[model samples]
Target: MHDPLQYEGRKVVVTGTASGMGEATAQILVDLGAQVTALDIKETSVDVETALTIDLRDPASIDASVAQIEGPVDAVFSCAGLPGPPFGELDTMLVNFVGARHFIEALIPQIVEGGSVGCISSAGALGWQEQLPILMELFARETFEDQKAWLEANQETWGWSGYLWSKYAIDAWVGWRGADLIEKGIRLNCINPGPTDTAMMPAFHELAGKEVIDSAIGPIGRYSTAIEQAWPLVMLNSTRMSYVCGEVLWTDGGFIGANSTGKQGGFGEL
Candidate 1:
């Protein structure tokens, strides 16, 4: 049988594999015969080629884990993230954007020339374009330390919602950095998933109330499964998607579309 997705025997690295979309993606890759190296703050139950503990908030931890993974990596699925509250705003930004970017940049040399990177952003980043100037400034700080310092100094600007700002950063980054990566024969893309029914749901519900979270759902009128969100991400990074570069695939069940058209209710009105 021919493998349309081309994941068979490929060396793939996935982060946040202990749970949610990351766990689902890792399992799917393993099932497709890819040699998966899973990274998470907690241990993953998935039977992957390698499983390493990593703390995205700490650059040392990220570097050490990346050092352990033998490379020439075919694909990278950046699925790790943190929901705001309970977790501090700074820590959330570090995990979702700063540290995640640092970790991905470090693995560039190991990633094959034609390889791709898929990341998980969120539908919450709906109005990111208006904030591009500030996001571009954030990206200008070339190092993880510098980015962290900038975030620390600018907390008053984005402190209200770390999750939203982090997602916005991811969306802007795919466009800003993806263009350069494509020149090197590497593609970068991300998915803006809507309200998903994962372990992270309770945190969101707690922070914004279930009604607010539900309001984000589109015509689908329901939350998405982890695997449902994972498939688009997997496909985005597939060798077959050679021409798809720096794109933001909305895995958000038409929320973005309907919201834009003013046909959707709830948060769109806000």
Candidate 2:
């Protein structure tokens, strides 16, 4: 029999738990009997064992929050992120990419063998593989201060550049660091969610227009629900996905699959 309380007694850390996907994930973990330490810029109302206010843009805040959590961490859900544009490009990059990497690295010692780290990426990060070289350079930057300077110097003309590039760098970092993690018996993976209706959806529409958001759903025809995105994240964080490492699971309805395969009936298909 499958156990809903399979996670009983496990310890998990989840960021962005104030609302949306992170909130959903933290609640699910708590309900399943795990001790969840939730983090968000604002106070989280979710029913977690611990809630820590963390501004991911500030390394001091990140370190301070981590210092408060007691360990033997079984899983980590890197869900805090910024969508960019009106949200400051440099800050977006710092929060989404650098913050996640730093937190996971900090907790490496606390992660037990067979532990897992699941990152929330986006379908927009699909092109990351080809951009590995440059992304790696930024990922290697020693400090947020250093990266902030580089991000300020190379701001893109488009509004979503920070968001898109941050996700790209995150996806690339997964593959880059996967082997090292796996060697420690800790698996690293990420999920790429398509457009989903959340509080953040309105901001997306404001930045890209409603039509762009609507048309991006691919064959799915509708925005995914928060639970839909959260379930995959939970599975990845659990022992169920022990062998799954260095992978980017596109829970984007069918958007990523369609893009990869191309229009199926377009050329030479009977």
lDDT at residue 77 of model 2 (Cα atoms): 94
lDDT of each: 0.94, 0.83
- Candidate 1 residue runs with Cα over 4 Å from true position: 266-270
Q: How well does model 2 score by local distance difference test?
A: 0.83
RMSD from true fold, candidate 2: 3.4
lDDT by residue (80-186, candidate 2, tens digit) is 88888678877888889887788888888999999999999998786788877777677678676776666676565322488888888878888889878999999
What is candidate 2's TM-score against the reference? Answer: 0.93
Deviation (Å) of 100 in candidate 1: 0.6
Each model's TM-score, in the order given?
A: 0.98, 0.93
Point out where model 2 deviates above 4 Å. Answer: 2-5, 156-160, 264-270
lDDT per residue for candidate 1 within 1-270, as digits (tens), equals: 698999999999999999999999999999999999999999998999899999999999999999998989999999999999989999999999998999999999999999999999999998899989889889999888999999989989888988999999999999999999999999999999999999999999999988888889989879999999999999999999999999999998899888878788746354
- Angstrom error at residue 140, model 1: 0.6
RMSD to native, candidate 1? 1.1
